[model samples]
Target chain A: MTPTIPILRVRGHLLVSVQGELGDDVVEQFQNDVLSAIERDRGRDGGLLVDISGLEVVDTYVARVLADTAAMARLMGRHTVVCGMRPEVAATLVQMGYMLDGVETALDVDDGLDRLGLPR
Target chain B: MDPSLTEVLQFDEHQLRTRLAFFRIGEEELDRLAAMRPLMEEATAQIVSLFYEHLLSQPETRDFLDDPVLVDRLQAKQTAYFLQLFEGRVDLAYVENRFRVGAAHERLGVPPRWYIGAFDRYLGLVRERLIGRGVAGAELVADLAAVERIMHFDAALAIDAYVAGHLATHARNQAALRELASPVIRVHDRVLLLPLVGTIDSFRAQQVMESALLGVSEEQARVLILDIAGVAVVDTQVADHLLKTTAALRLLGAKTILTGISPQVARTIVELGVDLKTLHTRNKLSDGLELALSLVGREITDKERGS
Candidate 1:
């Protein structure tokens, strides 16, 4: 069974908090879920915020999944701001040469809301 | 250049023999030293007492020998050391023992000048005794030459150990300075300031990366301003390191603003054709801070202090 990632709505912005390492299938499911949530929240100017602070490790595969989700969200007329990325995970991603270049980043949920032009 | 700690510690029998040969202390000198052992043994206690007497007279040396119990113990050790010189068995064991003596003096914080002066005084006493004992001209000169050569050899070993200890301490201090050089200061909430100074080398660049990344994580910082006004040069290598750090910070949800680029460094960066499109740079640290503040969804608005 694929573990489901929590995707909550805060101020109309989708906040996805990833905890621990995810298997390949789980990450794929998360990507699909994030896109579906963005489609469900259509007509509302909400953005995506992924909180990977609790994730101890983020290999290249997980990083690509998040980046892909952000790219798909952009096509649906919504922005995605990745927030609460731990430093070690960032370092690992950078070392592995996987840069989520087009995705916006913020410090936390409040900053994420600010990025989406929402009241913090 | 001073020898490394490993070289000093590994002063083997071959090295000892080479040093003896360098000092021209051949079989003849060893024979002379053995021949004069009885006379030197008789004068050992007197020599040690006289040496300590001269040392105790000096204010600097007197401070180190303030305790009478330690003085007594050291005096006994000095007597044995003096007698060992005349016994003429200058082997690896003997050289190793001399190294211990030098290391002990170094640990005690005794300066080189005092010990050197003490050796001179000790040699003078021995010369005076040899004359007083009615030793003739040619034999006296030969014995004195041997004694001087041996003293020189012992001094070399001790000084080597002393210098090696100092070099080790210098290395430890340098390591501490490297750690201090890269300080990640949290100038504002969710914003960090790393003011880098000195020349950028690969080692220091690694230090900067580790410190900045760890600082961002611990502070949960959203923005970092790296002010490099004090950095001496901006070569391609340095630019590469800075870019790598900036890219890493971006992944951690932090925007890195490079600041404090001097006019010359700016020209060099342009001339060098280093690509810095992904990095945000400002002229001064304050400007960088402004950019950083804005990135974190905050701004520094001017208002009355009372308000």
Candidate 2:
């Protein structure tokens, strides 16, 4: 059984930190939850921050999902920023040919929030 | 040279003797050894013969004796070595010879394990001969104890030399590999070239960042051309490292321009949906240089002044 990833809302912004290896189904479910949470909040100015700092390696599947989430968030008028991409993980991702298109990245959560310019 | 090897070479004969002084190997023992010269001479031939016979019996030992003539000569050399250990006076020549012997063993690819094991058999043979001499009681006990110290000290010197040589070779290879893998070269007055040639793992990636950054600061380079023509893969981890390196260079007031990203890498990045738009990139080194030159207010106008 896959543990559902929690998407927390702070100051109207949705923050989803992927903690471990997520199965494709779990990632898809998380994506749906994120979109639903954004709609429920009904705050178009608020953005989504997907943190992948906890991940050691983001495979081709994970990379695609992350990219799509960014695109979908944008479509919903939410800015998505990826935070805490480790140096080694980034290198491996690039080596594996992941450009992480449309995913704005920051060093950490604080940096992500700053980039998003959210209140409080 | 490796620091360990340098340390080993520094232990001269006087120092080594003093360090092993706990065994009470002094002038009195030398006198006793000289007094037993006849016994040493009488036992050497038989000891050498027995030593070779024992060595030849074991598959591990027989491998060292590749040529019959060479083995015969080594047996004679072994006889001299056995006699020299009990020859009264410990001199620089003795330690020097031991070092040469160690160097030879290293060349022969004879690991220390084999030689150290062989010492035990040599000591056993020597003990047998000492006992057969009928030199009994306290005298025999004292003589044998002294003989053990001499042999142990001998083994220490040889093994020390062997280890030193091995470490030196190992250090050399490590340095060579480091140079080949991570190089930060200055191509122009303010532009640096880092041509990554091998697979970039996390460790190498970190090293690349460190050395490249150091070069940036040291050379005061305005632009770093990261040429990955030789790099075969750029997994997410590798890409992350590249970005991190670029970010670091940015902090130092230097711009990082990536070049030589092949079609497969490009396809992989696009397929994975990685956004590399934030970085300044060019298809080739020449294109990157053109941009770098422009950044420094230098332009390459055609010499003919017309197409």
Candidate 3:
């Protein structure tokens, strides 16, 4: 089983970069970790930034989990932003029929942070 | 049909053969074929040589037999083909062989017209030889009729092969064109540009939406400029497709600016009752770019002002 993606707190936002392959266990762990991190950092309620640039492939199931994670985070008062999807992965995910609806996205961690952390 | 391409095209060979029954090959033709075997064995080598001589001489068919080595190889195959053809050995294997002949020619860029023309040459020679052997008027006519039926069957099978090849090529081209149509040009760090051209259909509309949403997220674009200046027509579905793409991008925290909407397109959108209310529309890419720059907190100033 691959290790759980690391969740870091940078200036109040929860930052997670998904690298390599995520096993079934790893994705389940990721979901639990992000949810708990939001709960742990309650006072600030800073956004969540999930960067997937390290991934070469992302299947529909994984894409669904990412979207679900963002939606779950949003209900907890923390804005969840997904960022850094590779072009190949994006094309594949689109082909796989994942729209990633309502999940905030940005080019990288910096862009994602601004999109989520700052007001529009 | 090559089974793989046939599977994709849903081509039915059994049905095709049933349809080709109009050419009329039967037991009587098979009997005539058996009668011709001894003579065909003697004639096969010479006829194969003459057939290729005619093909290689023609500028059109010559290209199909360009390599001298390949021509030599084909002459041997054609010799064996004719010998078996007259021996009444057209079982399942022979039918399959006939299909392969057509497909092979189609792949090598040999037109069916040439194959039919080759039959004309073969028939003319066969008439001369049968007459030389003392097979007279009515029997010769019957023999010729049987031969004609078989050649027609061969020609029809070859046409099926050609059609299948073209269908496969057309499908491949469409897939390539879709990939080519959606190009995401990233102009700035936080800005992405999409210039949509040509007629938009529901299929391509879905393509555009998927492409734009994914591009916006992939590039982390804060602003997207969708320029539709070259698009000839827009209807309700197209308007809906564009709106869905914009909405998806907006939720991804990207602002979308629809630029290059011709006066005609804008009227079509409004008349069709697609709300362009939420979108920031622009007449030109320059205006769209300026707005995108401002959205990303940048500005372009004249050199004279600083000087």
Candidate 4:
């Protein structure tokens, strides 16, 4: 059985840490969980920090979904930041023509949280 | 119609009949003479100059006819068309010839409004010129009536040609857009085959998305086999496009089977750290075809079936 990924919430920031192959199913679940957390914390200011350190290469679909999710969160008055995208993974995503337009990217989760103005 | 009359008008019997019906005038000598009046007015240098002056005064028409050489050629062509109207031959051959000329201009992207405006100005000049000559009574009215009929026919021809040209251009643009979206390949009832031939880019990826969606919607296809054997190399960009397209297909409830990944492409995908384990990819088109048939619950017999 595949190991369950962990989602840790610190204050108003939600941290999604996955340690396996990030496929379509995993991406769908991650998106749902993040949206649910944002809805649960509605009317309160918060942020989302997605840590993808375990992932080596992020596919085009997931990249697009991440960008879309970030946009959606921003529209709901929530700031979203993506962190720990490996150089190789970032290169792969760039080659795939995934526009990282609205989503903020950082070297690590700590930096990502800092960018969101949330205390680590 | 006499053979000489047909030769001069360059229209067959059927075309002449259609044109005569459009003019609402028969092959009678008086009606034929009346039709010549408009042509005579159009051929005169004074009326032609007046028509040009009016066209040049309008910015829209003036811009299109800015080239002096083109203007000269157009004037020469119009003069010839005018002379043909009074050739004393009312046949389908003459009408067809006129239609062909109008169609040629339409293909050249000349707007119908330009031809109509030019004819309108020509008519006004003819009316002024004839009235100033002290012409009156039924004779003058009959002459004017003939001129109007010929001009109206010419205008109709020009408009028809313009419409045909616009339709043709629209169809061509649609086809190009469709091709850009997806290289569509028709397959048998149980099969949906798409061959990837050239380089794939992001813009092409969107096109592929539209095309694949259309194929799935129209064919109700149970099996979609994408043949990439013709592709030269599978770069990361191309691979990403394929992955996105596959994901989109799945969302639309369509199953996509990729085929024709050369060994080099396999190595590249591995080197790039892209995972293809979730995808049903094959090395050959035939293997993909077999898989597609199995998904559709159909068998490929030894005998070839209709496409």
Candidate 5:
């Protein structure tokens, strides 16, 4: 089995970097891992930042999973910012009718950090 | 009817017959015209010269008539056309020939009134000549009536071809305008501007969407400012098109700022309840530009007065 993606605690905020084309199982595992990380960091004041800059493509299923993760994080009292989506990927996602609604976006990791109230 | 000829002339035999019937020209009238053909054939030269004199008097035609060779050539052609009227056969060939001449005149930018007026002069001169030859009473009236009906019928066919030419030119211009309608401008390093003016029909809306996507991807634009102040109407359909554009732009990682909302348009949007939550709108283009600059991490500041 491929190992689940990593989630790191950076300056009291959870940071997740998703790269390349991840399989459905890997994305689901990452979703569970992110939720638990958000649960464990419930006392933290910062938001969750997801950096997808390394990802070249994102299918509708993966987009849905990310949006779900963001909503779950918000429910846990942590706002989530998904950043670094390439222009083509974003265009394909919107064209495919997967809007990724209810999720905040940033230009890159730095912008994501800035949105999360963490200056870098 | 020849399909190719009818297609080019946009007139079939049935249509021509209908026009002739409308002008009340029947076999009796055609027979009368054919009988007078010899008389008209003899008078063709005199009538054509008189017609040219009238043409030379007009400022628009004087330029073409200045060349003696050209005027002689035109007069020869005009004589043949005048004699053809009294030939008494308004067949497919006759209709096709008239259509071709009309289209040629349109290409040369000759106004309809000039050709119509030329026909009127020819008719008047023909009546005068027939009477001068001592044809009297019912016979004079019959010939004049037959000539008038055929001339008017010919005029109708020519005008049809003229209108067809105009419609083709209009369609060509519209296609060119559509191409220039949507232009995406890259104002800053990572900002693009698309100023939309006029109505947003489905065809133009599709163009706008394609331009926006291509512009955003090409420029790697972080923010796209769409100014619709020149857009006169803000209906539900226009709002829907704008929403789709913004939604697509969002996926491309570029934020869309809609500017140029007149107060009247703002009221219409509210009245329609267009659900503009997904879109970011500004009252003026300048405000949208300011916001777009900030989104791309750049701003204009006053220069230091004393360095």
Candidate 6:
């Protein structure tokens, strides 16, 4: 059986839990899914929470896609909060010159939810 | 015409002419010029090696030396430059030639600062080498000083040309960046507001990331708001910038909020098919402001509130 994308709903916020390798292909699909959710909830007052706990390595391309996704959500009138980014992954993103110009990042899902003004 | 008088007069004339010509010629002149040749060659070679060694030791200059072809070309030019020093006459023509080479480097975008350090070290090496060769007399010192004087004159001209070219390039870049304003701003005591405006290309995106990182650290900001309201479009590239920024801000231990998304930007986000299901973003600047305030444990009334 093909592995399914793990998406959990918390307080009306879509939480996409990513794990393992976040390749360009996987990240592309992930970006599409997040965009779909934002569109579904357009004109709404909620946000999405992304948990990237399982990611070990993020290449320049994947890192860029993740940032772009957050920006796109903001345009959709929804907030994009990413949580559970590994320390190593974060370092790689920094070294690769990834710009998070206008994205929100939190330590964990709880912190991310809180930043989005969502209840635990 | 008189036998005794003619002989005496002819003899006197030849003697006077010979003595006058003799005064014009010096016996030690040829020997002195010849003796300086070997010393000049030795000093030139030593200076070249020392220059290369100093350049290789520097990280910035080392890259320029990585290519074997380029290294060889540079070494050859440097050797030629040294040899030209002792070519007997130090005239305006020689100075002009050196100046032309230096100006060429300036046009080629070579910085003058590196040349100063390299030239200084080269002189020190020449002194050390000369000292080892048992050449410590006042005459030797004078010769070395002359060489240094010529080099300094050439170096100054090169640096001036380089500075002019550098300023021109800087002016152009400044003009471009000025339109974008400062990518970063300090809003609140512990908060930084980086309102990313215009279409952010990859290079500009990197600048934004670096600016944000540096601004946060230098400003000791606890909260960072990436205000994107003025951002006209949000394609995949834009989305990628947001993700990278978010990831980076989290690492820096600063809370980040993405604010300002217009309706047109929203449609682009959907059309591009990017997933931002798990990121914090706000439709308006005020929404982000509220979130930033909460992070700092501050609340605002209706005046600062936005729907």
Top-TM-score candidate index: 3
Which residue runs of candidate 1 sit more than 4 Å off their true CA positions? A36-45, A95-97, B1-71, B74-106, B109-175, B189-191, B271-277, B290-307
Give candidate 3 regions above 4 Å deviation. Answer: A1-6, A16-33, A51-72, A84-102, A118-120, B1-35, B44-81, B87-111, B117-153, B168-186, B206-222, B247-255, B267-278
For model 3 chain B, the run of ten residues with the poorest summed lDDT: B1-10
List the candidate 6 regions with Cα displacement exceeding 4 Å. A1-91, A94-120, B1-168, B171-181, B270-277, B302-307
| Ranking 2 against 3 by lDDT, winner | 2
| Residue lDDT tens for model 4, B87-129 | 6565555555666777777766666767777778878877776
Q: How would you encode candidate 1's per-residue C-alpha lDDT over A1-120 as one tens digit per residue?
A: 678888898887888988887777788888888888877876787777888777787887788888888888888877788888777777667666677788788767776777788733
Say which prediction, candidate 2 or candidate 3, comes out ahead on TM-score.
Answer: 3
lDDT of candidate 6 over B88-114, digit per residue (tens): 444344544555566567775566777
Indicate the residue-level lDDT of B98 in model 1: 87
Query: What's the distance in Å from true for residue B230, model 3?
Result: 1.1
Deviation from native of the Cα of residue A102 in model 1, angstroms? 1.6
| B235-296: candidate 5 lDDT, tens digit per residue | 87787677778877775557899999888777767776756787789998998999989877
Q: What's the ranking of the predictions by TM-score, best on top?
A: 3, 1, 5, 2, 4, 6
Better of 2 and 4 by DockQ: 2
Q: What C-alpha lDDT values do all the predictions have?
A: 0.84, 0.78, 0.77, 0.68, 0.82, 0.68
Which sections of candidate 2 miss by over 4 Å?
A1-120, B1-8, B184-192, B197-222, B227-254, B258-307
Calculate the i-RMS of every candidate, to one decimal place.
1.5, 7.4, 4.5, 13.9, 2.8, 5.6
Q: Across residues B269-291, which tens digit of lDDT does each residue of candidate 3 receive? A: 78777555667888999999999
C-alpha positional error of residue B201 in candidate 6 after TM-score superposition, expressed in Å: 1.4
Clashing pairs in 3: A106-B220, A107-B220
| Backbone clash total, candidate 1 | 0
Better of 3 and 4 by DockQ: 3
TM-score of each predicted structure versus truth: 0.60, 0.53, 0.65, 0.42, 0.60, 0.37
C-alpha lDDT (0 to 100) for residue B123 of candidate 2 = 87
Which wins on DockQ, candidate 4 or candidate 6?
A: 6
